[model samples]
Target: MSFLRQRKTTSQIPLYTGLQIQTSSSAVPIQIVYGANKIAPNVIWTGGFSYTTEKTKAGKGGGSISGYDYRCGFALGLCEGPINAVGGVWSGQSITYLWNLGLGLFYGSMPQTPWGYLTASFPGQDLAYGGLAYVATASFDLGSSPSLPSLSFDVHGLLVGTGLINSWDANPALVIQDLLTNPQYGVGFPAASIDSTTLLGGSGGSSYQAYCTAAHLALSPVLANQEAASSILSRWLQLTNTAAVWSGGKLKFITYGDAPLTQSGVSFIPNVTPIYDLADDDFVISDDADPVEVVRSDPFTAKNWVTLETLDRNNWYDATPVQVWDQNAIELYGLHMDSSITAHEICEPSIGRISAQLLLQRSLYVRNTYQFKLGFEYCLLEPMDLVAISDVGLGMNKFPVRIVSIEEDGSGILSLTAEDFTGGAATAAAYPVQAGSNTALDHGVSPSPVNQVIIFEPPPDLTNGVAEVWIAISGGLAPIYKLADGTTGES
Candidate 1:
């Protein structure tokens, strides 16, 4: 027969539903995929198990089923290629034959399997897998391949392909021999040959090469020993390992300089501890003699700006005596006189001048351009504290007061001398001048008169010895006096 175009292996095969079909007693371990056509068609049973190995003629066929649902876990990777059209015939092909054409089962254990081997036979194979079983076979009718109705079974230790289980290989005790042997002959067959050229149809004639090349690649490989491969695999080649590292290929390390170091040349020391670490505060300042920066919002006021020194009267005769740059630094020390003034004995002043020295830091004089005010208050404390006798008289005046004079040379001293009336009767223990008896006679005194000649030193910074003057009378009434209209009169 000429080789004809054969369609891909049974694509419409329904999943095995674990429905058992009765078979002839002569069938060794059960034709799990058999039907009236004498050969079962190919079909897949997802979520089912099948045995990958079978027994020999000398022993009953048996082996553990290898699949996700099998007693022993096995993973099968079906290659993405066209499946074979030969089905239902139990082609009696070797494991390599089925594998070369992108069909086979991956056998392994759940936790682990120390050892395993593939098996096949013409008939009389035993079942060792414990789970639902499935069988796939093909029937070509009218030049088209249609898969046979699959055998549904709960048979333990059955065999299977990635997509389906072969019908003739469904015996409960089917061995490798039964799968490749003609059912009628109980002898070795060409399909069961272990010769690599005949089985995998490869020049190298190796089952490993055929199986490995034909198996579909896994997206991720479940490892038998994760730690071993993890240690061997290069990080760059590991698709699942996504960690990134810097130049040194080590974890990150960071150091910070928080404070000055103790070494003379070093500016800072690394703070080994983190910010939250309490012990990180061991750093010290760089130098012992370091200046601090101060920012002032407003200049100092009277409460804190300047400090005062003692006053000086020794330079009372000097022109530039109190060399004070700013008067704020010059303080006067004297008896705090009451706000009262009186004339005792008409001129009984303090016996001698009171004096004190002022010592100040030289900065006060060097920096000039400052001003200040010296303040004092004087008032009459007793009546008759003031007396005035004019050129006309000195109370009962007789002598004529011709001239009156006053002088102050900026020496802080004032000299006052007045000429009184010459035509006046003398009074007992008083000035001997009288135009009237012991009384202020208006007619006997001149309108403009000089009765008192008082001399004293003025306060600091005097000009022309001119100052405000006042006098109090018997009623303790004080009236300011000024030189006006050729006379010292009340203003």
Candidate 2:
């Protein structure tokens, strides 16, 4: 006996409403009504959804939901207002008008103070529940026809926990460790388990420990716990030469020297053969037609030089300048000041070097952005996930890229923005090689090997009847040095 196999049919799924708004003042959730009513046929809820993340610079995510509220003759009985009254209020039976007037549970003024959550979920999708969300703003349209009422909300991702309102003076790493291990901080998972890949232990572990001891963070009136953690983690990464990523429901602070993600390491691939077929209408591609490649002119410079200046606990000042310039860039565009950044929290020479390394790496600029849209059946990719794109026609043949952003339209389409993984390699190559003690300067300062030497005559005003020349060295430590009176010393 032979069994017959059934083929699955593909159909577009319509989005069903699964939104609930609960305020701190109310015990029950507010039921949002959609569509027209008998007395107010024009008043209808169009649609609204929010998009938020903790990955962005704002360190918070927010989105708005909007709909139409038109006033027609058939709805005038429901929209009639009091005459000759100051701040005249509407006594309409229209649901939109009622919502606009802050009537019922849809209190428009509730969000002015701290309110409750706006939870969302998809009925049939796995892991469809959204994080707790705070309603930031809600406004109703008051214009003529087809007015839209929108409610803007922010997701309670990493920054919704109790804030550190007091001043904290301690080792940056210890503070971070305390926050990561504390449940009140809302960073670590249950039982305060951080990912093992964290940089607290590694070949660079000793250096990280030194960084913890050397740098002191004085944080006063810090924001939410997540934000404070993010701030401290950011400083620690800069000082300890590492990176932090929130993945798998845990926070992991890894070093930049870690191996890149390969095809074997990715959770899953989307739009690939055997898994997905673009030829079979599985995905659509959109490339940036006029992508920027390089910086060719002024005001568009990279950080070739970084000066780290800090004061110790005893108020002793220490300044260390590191230069990592591209000779090709200088020959092509001349010397442009990339960054003269200052960090007061850095105290150790090793931390200063790490900070310099980070700044130097970021000085290498390259921009190439691409976007793709995949069907809902395809697995969703989060920001910073590594994936390979294979498009022969567009010269993206199995090229690995990092996801920059992801968006899901209500129509079951997932959109993603991916870019070339140029992770600090451009300027990494420009890092100066260590030199021997014999190459040290007469003033007991040993500078890195110079890549390019530039000499220029001083302007007449500053010379004061003396012949003066300015010397600029590129690609080594200390790109700019002043020498005077034929002395071979840096001034």
- Residue lDDT tens for model 1, 165-185: 122111111222232353432
Task: Give candidate 2's TM-score.
Answer: 0.38
lDDT of 2 by residue, 1-491 (tens): 33676767644333323222221222222211111101111221222333222221333454322332332110111111111111112233111233344422221221222222222322222121122111121332233223323322111112111111111123343445554664433356453455543424322232222223222112211222124456656764664444566656766553333222111112111121122223313454347532212123232355455555532211122244434455666677667665455554443333345456555554544345667777677654556566666665565555656565677888877886765555444222222323212222378666566677889998888888688899987775544554666545532
lDDT of 1 at 159: 28
**TM-score to true structure, per model:** 0.12, 0.38
lDDT, residue 252, model 2: 55
Question: Which residue pairs collide, candidate 2?
Answer: 48-65
Candidate 1 local accuracy as lDDT? 0.22
For model 1, give the 10-residue run with minimal summed lDDT.
Answer: 347-356
* Candidate 1: segments with Cα more than 4 A from true spot: 1-219, 222-491
